[model samples]
Target: MSEIVTTRQQTPGDLQRLDEAPTPAEYLGRMLSDRPALRIGTRTSPMAMAQAGTVQRLLDERAGVASEIVGISTSGDQWMGDLSKLGGKGAFLKQIERALVMGHVDIAVHAMKDVPGDVPLAEGTALAAYLPREDVHDVLVVREGSKYRSLDEMPPGTRIGTSAVRRKAQLLKHRPDLHVDRLRGNVNSRIAKLDAEAQFEAIVLNASGLRRTGLEHRATEVLSTDIMCPPVGSGVVGVQCRTADTAIAEALRLLDDPMTRTLITAERTMLHGLQGHCNSPIAGHATMTGDGQLSLKGMVFTREGGKFAYAQEWDAPDRAAELGAYVAAVLLRKGARGIIDGIPH
Candidate 1:
């Protein structure tokens, strides 16, 4: 490991700042006896680093902890050139989680959607907490000067692009006349494919992706949940650390937003119970109301949207998991299982 390097010299304003900044020694003292540097393992992608950096900054401000990002190239980033071909979810998180289990990182930060339902953390490792969510909607980006305002408005046979089976199925179900195609890459790369190659008439992308990459301006239309329910845990940030590392968990506690976590918990449970992943044609969304209740909306659809199965909203914090399970059961009862099993797998 290299010595910790500060990019900028300490200035009067930085020194006087009362937001709680810790020296390297201070942070290291709490971590291990040798006080090795705090290594935050993360994917090298721009968006991944941005998310990790945000938490690192907050750790300093809120907990007086200092750390550095240890960029690790994962399989997901390596094969960004072709994602759809790589089956299943957890594509982006497996390597990072492995690094954590191998003691390369003290803590791991992740976009909740990318994390697998089955994470085998080392004996003492555990998920610390999840941060608040961002907007959970998919956006449509068409070439400039396009008169189409919605998917229904687009001409039949229009080429639609997406990397997720969930989105492809949902959109096709709504507009059977349109054609869906595979799109894979970072936000910038996807945009290039659309603009340069004109390979797709429009692309369905997570609204949060656009915000994270500062490309929201390209969004021609934001599809609501009514049109396209987002993937489970789409916009939440999750933090994981060794379960024995009480100090790190306590330090990260302040970052947890309980209400957001509660709602996302239901969404994730729904996904898990349904055995769904990035490649599955599954979509669900959850929201918490001021009346101290949780509401969840979920759906299962075919790739071409020829048929769909949906479940009603369930409101009950204590039964959040049950609510999700109930929805899946409902979908199963509605012939969703047959449709799901029919996929080419």
Candidate 2:
């Protein structure tokens, strides 16, 4: 089906539900084949719009469903300071999720990493689908025409920019001399600072995020997992809808990649088990093994990177969550609990 992409801006608030809205089952049964355009809610950030557009395209191309991208300004977007002040990562999602519940949008799109693993899905909502995984790696963003092309190549006292404490901890653990300073803003503004000012030698960004924003060429070098472990749910786009919308949920599930789903299940299970706050320097990754088993690796680090714990475990693909919990158990046994408690998010 040929699809037309449409963008709409919606206000986020306690929208009054239509007094006589159709029943949940009727909403699905009413238009299985000839449905109204699905409204996809997302933040208004450039990366967010790009991610939502991708979803709009996929639903049209793969499922023959039409969609409209709805951009909602969220609290996280409005607040430039510490995210912890607005309730950590949840700040980014509150308004959009509320729109979904209010019937202002039929679905919500999110970068899975931004979703807090410790928090339950907002009441009455469910994660219905996930796009195929992208590169689950961190990359270096150095100034154009700079001599530094990679992490190790940079000299001592080199100042690096990043927002996530996980990245800071891992970077410090790798090179104690290099400085990992907090850098915030959308990817574009962050890169702008690298070029306009001499304050930062380089900045680290997600490889997948750069690709989604069509800025992959800016990546100076891809950091191997050995050097920089990724956060849980990186490189994945998750779709959320009302819990009672079973038909819509199943339709979206058709677009999901099973392998990616299992991997995320493992990674998120570990994250939930750890109960690590947004400030906690916890990292975990899951990948399919060559032998058809699932391998999960998890790490916990002090904010300063001096103390850490790591564990890796394997299980059948069907046991993704089991492998995740087992790995968390191993890390906790090795004193991850103490390190996690010491950090104040």
After superposition, candidate 2 runs with Cα above 4 Å error: 1-35
lDDT for each residue of candidate 2 in 1-345, tens digit (9 for 90 to 100): 999999875534324345457554345445565767889999987888999998888776666667899999998888778788889899889999889999999999999999998988889998888889999899999987689899989999999999899999999999999988998888888898989987898999999889878899999899999989899999999999998877678668767889899999999999999988888988989998888999999999999788899999999999998988899899999999999999886
Q: Each prediction's Cα RMSD?
A: 10.1, 12.0
Best by lDDT: 2
lDDT for each candidate structure: 0.77, 0.88
TM-scores of all models?
A: 0.85, 0.89
Tell me how far candidate 1 lies from the true structure as C-alpha RMSD in angstroms: 10.1
| Backbone collision tally, model 1 | 2
Tell me the lDDT of model 2 at 253.
75
* Regions more than 4 Å wrong, model 1: 1-37, 80-87, 118-123, 144-149
Count backbone overlaps in model 2. Answer: 0
